[model samples]
Target chain A: MLTIATGNKAVAAAVKEVRPEVIAAYPITPQTEIVEQIAEYVTSGELDSRYIPVESEHSAMAACIGASITGARTFTATSSHGLAYMHEMVNWAAGARLPIVMANVNRALGPGWNVWAEHTDSFQERDTGWLQVYVSTVQEAYDTALMAFRIAEHKDVLLPVMVNLDGFVLSHSMQSLETVTPGDFVPPLHLPHAIDVTNPAGYGTLTGPDEHFKFRWEIEQAMRKSVRVIADTERDFAERFGRQYGVAEEYRYEDADVVVIAMGTLGKEAEVAVDLLRNEGVKAGSLRVRWLRPFPELDLSGRDIVVIDRDYSFGFGGVLAHSLMAKSRIEPYSVIAGLGGQEVTFDDIAGFVRDRTPGSETWFGVKGNV
Target chain B: MTEIPKEEYILKCTSACAGCPSSLILRYVLKAAGPDTVLVVPACCTSVIQGIYPNTALNVPVYNVAFAAAAACASGMSEAFRKAGKKTSVIVYAGDGGTVDIGIQALSGAFERETDFLYICYDNEAYGNTGMQRSGSTPVGARTTTTPGGKTHAKKDIDAIVAAHNPSYLATACAAYPQDLFKKVGKALSLRGSKFIHVLAPCPPGWRFSSEMTVEMGKLAVKSGIWILYERESGKVTINGPSKAAMIKPVPLEDYLSGQGRFKGISQKAIDALKSQAEQRAKHLQKEAEGIC
Candidate 1:
């Protein structure tokens, strides 16, 4: 069925279809509507799930961990500060290897207190052992959320997953989404270490030096195994719903001489830039990385890549540019743009591709030259 | 004495110190909670006492969580159990540092939501696991490693703070009195909504006392009015233990403070102040009890 919904509502709709046993979340801007809609679904009897209005984001994640380790499908949503607060438990969920799914609205962290779209929030948690997938549209938000459970809970890949969407850009913007029926795409949750009274099991135990390294290695092994699980889950979803998603989606890349690489809604904007560049007869295309972790293998060997990053690593460089460089030895012309929800239209992106030099970074629209 | 139950859910081997009162309190509570209980323990002494991974002292399932997250974790566990169609008792066992200081927000949230679980705070006075540091539950004039001279302020009224949330069952228990603590745990298990029990677990090393004097220190605490025993059920408060023996004058504060090296050479002025504070609190409890049914 076709319906008009914001990215937040799309996530809620997908979660409803998955039918998680427990939903725990605290309201944070851009992420608030997702929980509000879930609450509505619970109250309206559309979804039979326990909704815990947790006091803080830390508790929200803690509660999710509580439910998740009990063989229950659990979910929660949060924005920048909420995500920061949930930092400790966010790491806990992944380290414990619970297949919990969370829809994180990508917002910039505060000191200046801006609640705008930025990748820095989720990017900071890059090493927390969570499989992070950034979505570009309302439809992808709905689709990726549904597939997250299957990917995370796959026997070989029992790790937490975070589906990140651009805070205000995708979270609040209305777009048409094709809703799928509740299918067997995601199987019933079965946590091998679930708390059972008949056969009790202890979780998140204290590990000493002798055994701690082995536990850490196991998480890494599961994370590596998720690449295959993610591919398989997406394939199954595509077969069932006739819509496909990949770890990285390439658009007009085959014949293009230059390609723009990005994640989230910036990728969608870059696609538009590709079209404009093509009309000008410039061989330009876009490679949108959907999954940040299980760091997808990309063939950026032949093409000159222009990496547009909505987030920066302070003293270092753009996250996407750094990843691409680390993977394929591609010297990406990293352009820092749209930070804290600063406007980066197709024209600005096209101009970046047209005027950029190879190697190093360029701070788009900033007065200072990099 | 109702013949304290012999059922034990804790294992014989524990990583706790020789005189750790928390282990005894946990053993007794677990005995009452039975086999169908899941403990959500935060960063406290119990976190270590439960032992390292692959070797837990607990026979029942335990979810060792981060500090300041026991109540929230238990809240989730309770809801999960309810969803799973299991009637298991979800319990949270935290220390003074985790409970009164760091974990209070989560505790208050759980209470407000009326989450069905038994929240226990094993008050060992200071952060005993971290080696005698000052915490919100550290009493007045008691010297911890952090408070070299002596703690300047009185202990935070955690029981009264929890009571403000109006839990289904609320009680203050002492490890020195095992039967009373066990009975309270059993009673709390019988109730439905949010329940909280504050257990004064005296730490020998932290209190600067000999390992053998753990029980004696706990008894003296109650006798000196430093640790009062009481229960709050549906807004009613009932004083228990030595505090209830109002007719016989309470034991002097020095009786509790004198022997412990932590309180060694404590001035008479500080003792008087602590005594006055305890008296005022006891009097307030009495007035509050009179107003209740």
Candidate 2:
């Protein structure tokens, strides 16, 4: 069925199709609506699941972890401080190899308490061993969520997945998406390590240094192998749903002298800027990074790259820019923009790409303000 | 009822100290919960007592979670079992540090939401796992590693705090009273919604007492009205066990305080104050129980 829905509703709609056995969540701005919609679905008998209204985000993730260890499909959502609060359990879920799916609304961390779109929140969790997928549209928000289950639960990749969408930009904006019924696309969940009462065994116990290092190495190996698993899952998803996606979504990058690299909604906006530059006799394109973890190594060779980061890592440069420079060995212009949900239009993005110097980091839009 | 079954779910050897009461508590708790139970333990003595990986003393499934997540984790396990249509009892076996202090928020949340599970706070009065340090459950004038001079405030009334939530079953027990502790555990297991069993588990080393005196200290604690025995079930409360007599004719608090080296400080004023406080608290609990009934 096709219908217009907000990004949060789209996530809820996808969760309905996924049919998780348990859903645990706490209300956080820009992420509350996702849980609220799921509650409505559960109440109306649209989804058969136990919705645990946990006290805090930490408990929410902890609850999901407990449920997931039992081989039950679990789901949760949080943003900014909520995600930060769940940091301990976040590592736990990944370490225990539970394929729990969470929707992390990208909001800026606060001293000023702003509930708006920024990548710093999810970006901070880049090394927590979770498979991170950044979505740009409401449809992709729904689609990525559905695909996350298959990717995370794959035998080769039994790791938790976090689907990132911008706080207000994608969470509150309305867009049309095609939905599916349960069991149509996503398969029934099957976890090999599920807790069985009749045949119970201990889980997540203390391990000595002799074996702890081996277990950590195993997680690293699984993360490395997840790349192929994710690709295969997305391919199968496209075959079933007729909608295609990749680790990195390319926009007119072929035969271009310049490419603007970005994530989330800004990645979508950069496509407009790319087209604008192309029409004005500038050979420009955009490369929208879809997933940051298993972080796909794209062939950014022979092009002047311009990286637009919505987050900055203190002492280091922008997260995306650093990752790009490390992987591609390219000194791209790293421009920080749209922080704390600050407005950065296509014109601003085009201006960033137009007057870019290689290897230089620019605090775009903050030049005059600061 | 039927002798409460003599089967021991936990094995003989544990990582617990020589006279740690946790082994006894675990044995009784598991006996009541049965083989089809899942235990969620945080960073407490039970976490270490369960033994190292691939070699646990427990017969049932154990999920050793983070310090502040035992209740929430058990909540998830119960819900998972319910959804999977499996007959499983999820229990949180946490220490006083995880229960009364760091883990209170999670416990309160679980109780408020009425998540179906059993939470047992084995109050050893201090953070025994991380070395003997003062915790919320540590009584006033008792010297701990952190509270070298002695804790300034009285023990936090966790029983009263949890009772405010009005759980399906709530009780306070001690290992010294095996039959009563087992009975409360059995009763809690029979209920459906959130249930709590707070056991005053004494730590010989942490309490600065001889290893052989753990059970005796537990007994003295109740006899002196320091640890009151009570149960709040289905909106009605009742005073239970040895403490019931102490409510009418209070025992000398000196008997309880003098036995432990933690209270070795020579302060007659503090001793009198503690005794008076225990007497007043017991009287208030008895009055509250009468009103509830």
Candidate 3:
């Protein structure tokens, strides 16, 4: 069915298509619409799923963990503070290897108390054994959410997957999305370690030092193997739905001299900036790294790269930029922009690309830093 | 009266401390819940006593969760079972520290939402799993590792807090009284809405008593009018036999406090305070039972 909906609604629509057996969630701004839509579906008898209107985000994730362990496909949604509050269970969900899917509307954390688009929230959870994919448009959000279940529940990749969309930017903004009745696309989940009522068992028991590392290694092994699972899932999704996605969405980079890289909505804007730079006769391309975890290699080789980060790591610089430097051993012009839903237009992004200085960092809005 | 089931969900040879009644409470709880049950345990002694992986001491499924999350986890597990058209009992077996302290919010949330599950908090009055640290459930004038000089505050009234939710079934049980504990679990499972059974489990090592005095300690608590055992089912409160008898002619409070090492250096003032509080609590329960509140 083709219709127009906000990014949040698109996620809920995809979830309805996947038809999770259980959904436990608490409302948070920019992400509240997702859960509200899901609740409406559950209430209207359009969806046959257990919807738990939990009091807090911690319970939301914990409930999902409990349901997921029962061999039931489960989902939940939250943003910023809610994500931060549920940080502990977020790690446990992965450690327990429960393939629970979650939609996180990217929003900045508070001290200054801003509830707006930023990547810092999910970035803080980068080390947690969760596969993360940031979507740029409502269509992509719906598509990735559908594929998330298939990828996370794959036998080779029994790990939770986080679908990220910018708070307010993509989450509340309406866009055209084509929803599909994902029958047979996402198969019935079979959690090998799911609790059985007939047979008494113990899960999440204490593991001495001797065997603890082995479980961690198993998670890593599954994560490393998920690269293949992700590729295959996305390929299958493209074949069935006629919508193609990749680890990184690259545009006009075949013979460009300079390429701009970003994520979420900024990644989409970066494409416009690339076109702007191209009109000015600048040989620039755009590369939006979609999947943050199981991070895609940009293949920048011999070209000057400009990386924009909507999140920063205070002392370590941009997470994406620094991680790329460590992995690819390349110096990219690192620019921190669009934090706290701060306005950064295509002109500003194009300007960042035009004045690309390798090995240097710039804070876009800072008076002295830029 | 239903005879106690002979089959045990908790097998012998676990790592529970000697004279620990928390495990005993679980033994009865599982027997009542039976094989069609899933025990959601947070970071408590039960988590350890359930044995390490590949060698669980339990015959029923146990989902050991993080501290302060047992109730919330059970809410999900129960919903999943019910939605699947299965009547698998979801029981949260947590300790005092995980209940009255760290896990209180989740507990309140689950009960208020009317999650169909039985929550049991085996109160040992201290953080026994963490080497006897002081907990909110620890009584006044009792010492824990964290309260070296004896605690200054009275025990938090978790029963009162839980009553505010007005669950379908609510009861207080002692490990010394397994029959009562067993019956409460059976009743709670028979109903549909949220149910809670708070068991005052005596810990010999944590409380500084001889291993053999675990049941005796629990008896003294109820006999002395300190820890009242009762059931509040659908708004009617019935003080149990031991507490009802104590109300008419209670034993001395010192009989309950004397053997516990946690109260070795109790001041005269603290002792009087403890006695007064216990008397006031008993009066309130007695009046409420007689429809006098």
Candidate 4:
């Protein structure tokens, strides 16, 4: 069905189509709409799912782990502080190799207390054995959430997946969404180690030093192999749903002199900036990184790169810029913009490309270049 | 005293300490819950006692979880089982620390939701898995490793806390009385909607007593009315065999406290306080049972 919906509602719609058997929900700002929508669906009999309104985010993830381990498809949604609170169980869901899907509304971590768009929250969980995908549009959020189940439940890639959307920007912004009846797109999860009620088995037992690292290595091995699974799932999804997605969404990069790289909503805005620079006769293009973990292979050998980061790593340079520099062996000018919902227009983005110093990082709107 | 099934769920060998009452409590717990059950355990002695990875010393399936997550996990598992159209019993077997300390919020959450599961807390009075550290459940005047000078705080009333949830069924048991423990488990499982069983698990080594005296120590606790045995069902309280008898003519409090080295250097003031508290609690229960104020 084709209709207009907010990014959060799109995610809830996709979840209803996928029909996860269990959903652990705890409310947090920007992410509350997703759970509320899901709760409404469950209450109205539109969707048949066991919705657990858990007390805290820790219990939310824990409940998902419990249900998922029993071979039931599961999901949950949360924003910044809730994500931080469930950090332990987040690692657990992946370590246990349960294919639980989650939607994370990207928001800033606080002291000044902001509930706006930032990538720091998701980036903080970079090493937790979870596949992360950032979506720019409502359609993309809906589509990615649907595909998350297929990718995570693939036999060779039994890991949890996090679908991230920019807080208040993509999360609350309304856009077109076309829902699908996922009949066989996401097959039933068959966890090899799932508990059988009839047969008595033991789980979460103490692991001696000899076997603990082996289990960790198995997780890494499965993660390394998920790259292929993700491609196959996305390819199959396009064939069935008529919407194409990739590890990185690219725009006009073939004949460009400089390629601007970014993620989330910043990626979409960077495309407008690229068009503005092109109108001004600057050979510019855009590549929005979609997958953060198992960051895909992009051959950026022959292009001058300008990277926009909505997140930072404190003492280190921009995450995307520094990672791209290491991966492609090229120094890209890094521009930090749109943090804590700081405004940055296409005209300003165009100027960033016009006056690009090869290895310099400019924090846009910071006075005196500090 | 129990015509309970002869089948044993716990295997003969595991890494649990000798005369560990928590394991005894679990053995009865599993037997009553049966094979078609999932035991949600936390970071307790039972977690270590379940044997290492790739090998299980249990007949029924166990889902080991983080310290504070046993009840929360059971909440999810019970709902999942209910949704799947399977009649699988979800039980949480945790230590007192997991129940009264770190796990209280999850327990409250699960019970408040009226989840269909049995929450079993084996109260050994201290964090036995972590070298006998003083936990919230540790009684006042007990000397644990962290309470070398003797604990100054009273034991946490975990039973009262769980009862506040208005559980479908609630009971107190001891490893010294296996029949009572087994019967309580069976009774709790017979009915639904968030049941709780708090068993007084006396640890021999932690209390500085001989392993052989474990059962005797539990018996003494009830004889002196230090640990009451009772059941609360449908908002009514009933004092069980040992506790009912102890209330009429109880043994001296010093008999319960003297044998254990943990209470060796305990002050007279602390003992008087413990005795007075026990007396007040028994009187309240007795009055409630007799329909008095």
Q: What shift in Å separates residue B210 of candidate 4 from its native position after superposition?
A: 0.9
> With candidate 1 superimposed using the best TM-score fit, by how many Å does residue B165's alpha carbon deviate from the native?
0.2
**In order, how many clashes per candidate?**
0, 0, 0, 1
TM-score of each: 0.98, 0.97, 0.99, 0.98
Summarize candidate 4's per-residue lDDT along B6-38 as a digit string, tens digits: 889889888888888888888888778788888
- lDDT per residue for candidate 3 within B122-219, as digits (tens), equals 99999998999999999989999989999999999998999999999999999999998899899999999999999999899999999999999999
Q: Rate the local accuracy (lDDT) of all candidates.
A: 0.90, 0.89, 0.92, 0.90
Chain B TM-score, all predictions listed:
0.96, 0.96, 0.98, 0.98
Each candidate's interface RMSD, rounded to one decimal? 1.1, 1.1, 0.9, 1.0
Q: Model 3: which docking level applies?
A: high
Query: What is the TM-score of chain A, computed separately for every candidate?
Result: 0.98, 0.98, 0.99, 0.98
Per-residue error (Å), model 3, residue B31: 1.6
Spell out the clash pairs found in candidate 1: none
Q: In candidate 3, how many Å is residue A227 off?
A: 1.1
Error of 3 at A265 (Å): 0.7
Q: Which residue pairs of candidate 4 clash?
A: A201-B61
Best by lDDT: 3
Clashing pairs in 3: none
RMSD of 2: 1.6
TM-score, candidate number 4: 0.98
- Model 1 regions lying over 4 Å from their true place: none
DockQ of each: 0.79, 0.74, 0.83, 0.77
